[model samples]
Target: MAILFSRRKITAWCVAALASLAACGAFVPAHAENLDAPLVLVVGYAPGGSTDRMARLIAERLSPKLGVPVTVENRPGEGGRLAAKQIKRAPAGENVLMLGNPAVMVVAPLVFKDLGYDPDKDFVPVSQVSSYDFALAVGNKLQLDRAMFLVGRLWAHPEEAVFGVPATGSLPHFFGLMVGDALSVQPQIKGYGGSAPLAADLSGGSLPIAIDTMDSLYAQHVAGKIRILAVSGKKRASFAPNVPTFREAGMKIDADGWNTFFAPSTMPQPKVQLLATKIREVMQDPGLQKAADALYITPVVSTAAETAQMLKAYRQQWEPVVRRSGFAP
Candidate 1:
């Protein structure tokens, strides 16, 4: 026999049925209750870059620790803003995260007036993964030998002292301007799409001075195609201890480039903590450390709290420098 019920009765019946299912452990909410979902580590730059390389390494180790599949996705645009915006708009429980650096997290806010996301408001720092320093290098094609002498030439002929950077509004570009300010000379700034071309020109002697990260220039320096004038850090880099720091060279400049993990701010605290812990654990592995060393990167395993403090301090330190550079994107 068929039975028919009123609308209210049908509604109550459905509610009772759902409650029974809940009691029987058969009901699952739309939001995933487990961390079994696939995790994606988004890289702002395309494949073959340092960030992409590091992301893949972390993903390989992180997958085992989390007991879930981990993959790297390259978004590659707008100086990492594209990937950053994608992470910002991802679903809360999707397990999407971004590997961020100063270009996207620190400098974007100051340079891009219409940046799609705010580093402070849209994201949470998970952990700091790696760090490296920048270096002021002169191409073998140039007729100069020392950074001090270069400064003197800039003062003597500012028009001929242009510097090349990977991109406009990048840390290297700002640092180039800072160098000019310290020496009280104005030189033209050349922006490239990536370091490869800048490096090629620098090596070919068309571009005399190139300011770039140590890793980007280290190979050329090793090949005897470029001379690293001075690195920017308190102490000399381990890989290039012979290269004096900018401070030791009489320029009181200290800047270090770093990479950190970030999750959407909407993620739950427990999940955030779990991700942070897992990343820190993976970064501490000896094998990972060896790989980072080979890549000329220092693996820094910092807690979420420490990561947050580091970002805050970094922003504070660079804010004045960015302002002084008078750059806007």
Candidate 2:
């Protein structure tokens, strides 16, 4: 005997069948299963900068592991405020992240009055990728072999020992102030447009001494054009192992710059966990480690919770130092 079915009955049967398949883990919604959406790693700097380079590297290694395309998008402006704002407003998905440093994540809040995004409220910590320390370097033209000699010169002739920083309210500027305080000399910080011009002047003897990242000054130091007196971390940088840290030089100060990954605060916890795990795995890749080493950056893999703790501790450590600097943006 043949049976005839109404449209309602046919629809009900189809729904039941689909439910049974889903229960057996044999079915998934089309949108949920589609993982082809491209992931974007946003950088707040122009292309070819260190942050941009790191973002591209992570994207290259992460794409294959996640089975989707991953790319870096630069949104440089207002010292990374623009990029942070965009990340805060990114759609509710796991398709976007940002490579941020202390400047954007920690310092900008204290410095800028009307920052578009609040670091604590607008973003979730994903992971910390790498970190480096600043170096107190002097031009070779100064002919100073010891860091103490530079201190003595500053103490005797404070007017002649002007310090150059890449920009105002930058890590270098704050670190310079700390160094000056440690030496008991009020720092005279001159902020240049960028590091290149500062490097040029430092090498030419016009800028006697300067504070910048080891990554920025290591090549010049290696070329015997500049003398790196000390680094501003608890441990010496791998790239400049011979240089002593500020503590070792009798300065009770420690400052290190770091890179972190952040997702919009609205992203789901499970999605955040998935992306953080993937990124931790990507950092473990041998090829990526080698590449990071070449850039003089140490590759670190951390959980979201760990990253949050680190961020908190970093803020606690730097808040006083920044406030003491009395920098108004």
Candidate 3:
């Protein structure tokens, strides 16, 4: 025979379960437990990409800690806007999170007229997972070692102003335009579907120069398939210390890009704090750090307050440049 609980008994049981989780600094929605809503990490890019790989890494270590089933969902489209939208519509108290980058969280709002959702109002920053800098790579056909040389070449040959960017409003795109302005040449940037194709073009001499995240081009650069002329950062990347920075090359262009984990706005503050703390713990794993290092990205763990400050800093640094570029939706 099956035993049934009265409404009062069920309510008391639910409250007791929540209290037990809170006593240990853990959080799991009682309703989610009742409905069996598994913890889901969302990646707003294709499978096998950097964001997807990072999401998988987080899920692997986070599942056992959270004591729940975890999975990664790829919702690729609109340069991460699709995944952001999905997170917006997620029900209150559901365990759905997304890996957010500047494209969706920072630049899109600065560029798009109708972004459909406000990142700050619709989502909550859990924790930052990694950081990287932008880089410019030259095809095998070009024999250049420093950014100044390419600047001179573009100044003399405006026809070679053609370049590649991973996405239209990405940090790389803006950084490419900034470099073009510094070169005083009319830059023609060709946006590709992803970094693989962009790197392929750079390798085959089909594209003379490309601007993208250092992580996006690290493999080909290490393989000696393409030459990264200058990195756009305050200093050279830690993984590629031999490479010179744009400032070191005397071009004065600098930028920093980062990736953070975010959840829907409806998630409770306690839940958000618990999640961010857990992510910080997961980021400390030696295996995770090793994997990130192999990809040429520096793994960083930041609190939600720190993440907000980073987004603000990037916006302030890029807004003037973007407005000066006169790029529109």
Winner by lDDT: 1
User: TM-score for each prediction?
Assistant: 0.85, 0.87, 0.84
Sort order, TM-score high to low: 2, 1, 3
**TM-score of candidate 2 against the unseen true structure:** 0.87
TM-score between model 1 and native: 0.85
Candidate 3 TM-score versus the reference:
0.84
What is the C-alpha lDDT profile of model 1 across 1-329, one tens digit per residue? 99878999999999999888655445534443346578989999889888899998899999878778999999998778998888888766578889999988988788788898989889999999998888899987666767887777777788877889998888888878777777787868899987899999999989999998899999889889999998887788776778888888888778888999999987766678788888999999999989987887878989999999998899888888887777888
Poorly placed runs, candidate 1 (over 4 Å)? 1-34
- Best model number under TM-score: 2
Residue-level lDDT tens digits of model 2 in 1-329 = 99999999999999999998755545545435224378889999999877888888899988987788998999999888899988898767448999999999888898788998999999999999888889899997889877778878888998875789999889999888878778888888899988899999999988889998878888888898899998887898766689888888767888889999999987766567777888998888889888987887767888888999999999998889888777796
Q: After superposition, how far is residue 11 of candidate 3 from its true place, in Å?
A: 16
Q: Which ten-residue region of model 2 has the weakest summed lDDT? A: 27-36
Error of 3 at 223 (Å): 2.4
lDDT of 2: 0.85
What local lDDT does model 3 show for residue 284?
A: 91
Clashes of each: 0, 0, 0
